[model samples]
Every structure is written in structure tokens, then in C-alpha cells.
Target: MAKLYVIGIGPGRRENMTLRAINALIKSEVIVGYTPYIEYLEELVEGKEIISTGMKGEIERCKLAIESVREGKNTSIVSTGDAGLYGMAGPILELAKDIEVEIVPGVTAAFSAAGELGSPIMHDFCSISLSDLLTPWSLIEKRIENAAAADFVITIYNPRSKGRKKHIEKAVEIMLKYKSPSTPVGIVKNSGRDGQEQIITTLGNIDYKKIDMLCVLIIGNSMTYIENDHMITPRGYDL
Candidate 1:
């Protein structure tokens, strides 16, 4: 039987890795992931044959992992966040094509980002991937506008890259159309890792020029507040 392991690496912290995920990693003979995801497991993945590639190479990487599994060697594919939530799970499963694939979930970056900002996502919120590589920007804009109109807190992923800039600012502009300029915005870059940065700003004060691809941006709803230097998005219990 060909067994494929779809694992979640959980942000960038080694300590954040779960016991089940660790066991899965240890048992795998070969590991496939993005370059950064592979580097994160360097110490944990001593001796396994590793295949690392760049961003947007997920389809190619998944193929390598699936082929390795078919050859009777335990093979695993790694993702940065939760396996299923905008992570590697969907791609891996699509490649599985009726094979028995094991899914080991991990914490998503948004949760880690939210924790760094002190539970800003504790209430009802929606997660959005700002990258328009696989999806259309028009669709992305509609969701942002709808999320803003519904007053739902939004967590954005893959905000800005070297080639793709200004998209995040466009998202902010959409939010600003429906949300107040003073609404709290939480920006977390490389959360749960060294060189981590956390900033709390507002729709009117955010500097989009300073943001990078790795940064995760959170735009609050109209009810969102900045309290004692923390960004908050209430669950609407307040009168």
C-alpha cells in the first residue's frame, strides 16, 4: 500500500510542533516541502532525504512526495500552517487520486499571529489569502468587501510578495470603505519565531510600503477597538 503523509509544520516555531506530527516526521524516510519549511525542520529531520523548492512550486513538490510514497518508502509533505486550511492538505489530496493519505494537522499562522496580538481572533472572524496566484483578484476583492460589509474581522495571508505589491493596500482600501479609518489593524510578521515583529495600527495609519510577503495583516471591523495598546475585535456582546 502506498501511504502518503500530509503534515502541518505550524508557523515557524519548532516547539509549536505537535507530538503526532513529530512522530510522523521521524518515521518518514523522505520529506518534501518548500525551502523555508524544510529549513525549519533541519534539526528535527536529520538524515532524511529532503527535497526543497521555492514558493508556488507546491504542485511539483507534491508529485515528488507522492512518487516516493508509491515506491514503498514512507514519504511526507510539509505545510506551514494547518494542513487543510489554505495549506498543503488540499493539494496533497488532489494528487493522492485514491491513495490512502494520512493527514496530521498543525496550528495555522493566523492563530499564531492572533496570539501575538492577544486573541484578536477570539471572536467571529474570516481568514483570507491575499495572494491572487491561484484565485482571481476580482473574487478576492468581493470577499474583502463582503467581509468588511458584514463587520467580520479579517485575517489576511500571503499579503505582499516581491513581485506582488499594492494588493494589501487595495484590501485596506476596501475595508476603509466600510470600516472607520480609526479601526484597529494588527500586523504580525514572522510570528512565534526569531526576528518577530508585532504592530498595532489603524486603517488610516498603516504603512503599506513597509510590509513584506511574510507579513500577516489583520483588519478589524467597525466595532474593533485599540485598548491599552492592544488591538481588539469584539464578538458583539457589548451594548
Candidate 2:
């Protein structure tokens, strides 16, 4: 039976990609993914049949992969970061009812960003995407509020886009009510890739201009602090 592999490419860098992911891609006959992700894997996928589409074409991309698999072609779909974390894993799994599916995990942007900063996610943490395209803003806000109330280290994805600008600002406002104004915040752009940039700021004074859709925003809990310009969240260790 033909198999479908949903692989995470991990920040679009060869070194960041897992051995399993690379092997799956090597074995697959067809590779399908978003254009940018496909372009990132050009070196590895040189001889394979590559199918790509633009943004917001997720369903189309998944359908193509499913069709390819049904035709007895080994297929792999690439996604940036962990496939399960706001990547193509969910859609592919949902669309793949009878096909044998293998999900290859990789480093997510949250962890990549955390590594660039310090250990801001050392304690209890939860990830939330600020994108309101599929999820309603009211529900997103509620989750953010509840997470803040629970003091979970928050890693926010898709914080800002060209069309949506005020969402991040509003999210910060909601967090400020539960967290301190001086709460440690780390912003990492293009993590694990060339020209990567990171900065440590405060919740009350975040440089909004520095953030984009490609960036990950880690808002630390009350227990989080900065030591020697590095963000750190204690895990209740005796030190």
C-alpha cells in the first residue's frame, strides 16, 4: 500500500530537519507543500516531482497529496516547524481517511525561538496562534486571558500579518491585565534560518514593528525573568 508522510522541515534549514524527515522525503516520489516550503527543500527534492501552491491553498495541497498516494505513489507533504503545530498535519490527517499516514515531527518555532532567547518555557507553557482566519477573535482572546490567568508561558504564532495588524496589540492588552507590565518577552524572527533575528523586550514596551507573520512571540509568565540579557523562566528548582 502506498504511504503518505506529513513531514515538518523545521524552519526551512537542512541542519534543522530531522533524519527521519529527510529519509521520508528521499523515499517519496512526489513532494507537495506550500510554495515557500517547497522552495526551501529544493536541494533535497531536486529529482522528485514537486507540487506547490500559494498561501491559503492548504486544502488543495492536501487533496493533491491524497490523490498522488491513491495512485500508488509515495508522497510527502512538507510544512515549516512541527507538522502538528499549526502546520499541515491536521488537514492532511483529516483528509486522509483510509490512507496509511505517518507524521514526522520536527522542531517547532516556539522551541527554536526559546533556544535563541533563554529557557523561557522551562515551566508550564501553552502555545496560541494570534491568527483569526479560522478561529474567532473572541475565542482567541478568551484563551489568551485564561492562559495568562493560569500563568502559562505563552508562545504566540502568526502574531501579525499584512491584513491583520491590531490583533497582537489587543492580545498584549489582554495579557497586561493578568501579567506585569515588565513581564519578559522574547521576539524571534526567521528562527533557525539565515538572517535570523531575536530581541528581548517587556510586555508593556514590545516593539511591534519588529514583529511579522514569520516571527514567534514568547510572552513569559510572572516567574520569568531576565538574567544577563537572557530570558529565563524558573521551574521551581532549588538554586
Candidate 3:
């Protein structure tokens, strides 16, 4: 039996790579990941076998990765952000149910963005992926409405992409219907790396078209505020 390690590479920087994950990668006979992720860590696996898959076909890629291990070859599958959240962990678990799998966690973009914004996630919040690829828009619509209705601070992942541009605006519309337009919106691009851009805006000011897959947008609840140019969402548990 071979080992299948599901790993999250975090964002882009090599320093953010986990020691354990690196060790696993070094031990694996093959490293499989998205094209960009493979390119990002290409140096680490010099001359090693890598099966790079495109952004789509994530499920098929996972199946191939599982098969590699099931066939007695060590494999490491890569994901961006934490493997447990919106990463390979879910699909890998769903696909490799009968196969022995190891989930190696990594830093998620929400936390990286939150840390740069000074604890917008310190309080109660919810995360929503605006992509309607695997998830239906109706279900996503209801969740957005309910998130707004509940006044929960929302951390939006994959808020906007090439074909799915209106989801973020729709989310903004839903949020504004229930909350104030002045609600703080913090956006972090390429968080925790060079070329990072951070912005503290409002729901009234969020331009959906400007966001991309690499961006993590944090929309604050009613109580969320900006102080000293830092976006802060109170934990609601008074210290």
C-alpha cells in the first residue's frame, strides 16, 4: 500500500509551506496539483514526476491521485489555502473513501486576509464561495440572503471569476437589502505574499468586476468598523 497525502500549499510564497507538507512532498514518488500550484512549487521537486492538471477537472485529478496511491505509488495532491476548507480535502475524502488518505492542512486565504485586516474573523462569521460550478446558484442565493439576514460577517472565497462576474454583486445586493450600505468590506489580494493589495471599503463601494479567484473579500456585519485604517469586526464576546 502506498501513501496518499492531501496537502494545501497555502497561497504562493514558499516560506508559508509547512515543514510536514514539504517532507511529504519530498517522500512522494509523484506530486499532482493544479498547474499554477505545480509551477509555484516546481523548484522543490526538481526533476521529479508531476502531473499538472488545469484549474477545472479537480475531481478527475483527485481520482487519478487516489489511483496512483492505490496502485502502490506514493502521491501528494496539492490545494491552495487550507485543505479542509474549500480545498482538496473535501473532494479527496469524497472520492477516496475506500482508500487510506492523509490530510495535511495548510493556511487558508480567509485567515491570511483576516490577519492582515486585524481580526475581522475574531467574531462570528460565515464563509461563502460565489462560484456556482458545483453548487447551484439558487442554494447559494438562499445562503447569501440568509447570511445577510442573520447579519453574519461573510468571508467570500472565489468571489468573482471570468464567467461568474455577477455573483459578488448579487451578494452585495442581498447584503445591502438587509444591512447598511456603509458596512465595511475588506478585500485582500495575494494575502501574505509580495504584490499583495489590501483595501477597506464598503458594500456600497465593492466593485465585483475588480475581484478575482486570488482575492478574499471580507464583508463586515453591522457592528464591524474601521479604526486607524484597519478593518475590525468585534468578536461579540465582550472581554
lDDT of each: 0.85, 0.93, 0.86
Candidate maximizing TM-score: 2
Name the 10 consecutive residues with the lowest summed lDDT in model 1. 230-239
Candidate 2 structure, TM-score to reference: 0.98
Which rank order by lDDT, best down to worst? 2, 3, 1
User: TM-scores for all candidates?
Assistant: 0.94, 0.98, 0.92
Better of 1 and 2 by TM-score: 2
Model 1 per-residue lDDT tens digits across residues 131-198: 88889999999999999999888999988988778898888889888898888888899987778998
**Per-residue lDDT of 91 in model 1:** 82
Q: Number of the top candidate by lDDT? A: 2
Clashes of each: 0, 0, 0
TM-score, predicted candidate 1 vs. hidden true structure: 0.94
Q: What is the lDDT of residue 81 in candidate 1?
A: 79
Off by more than 4 A, model 2: none
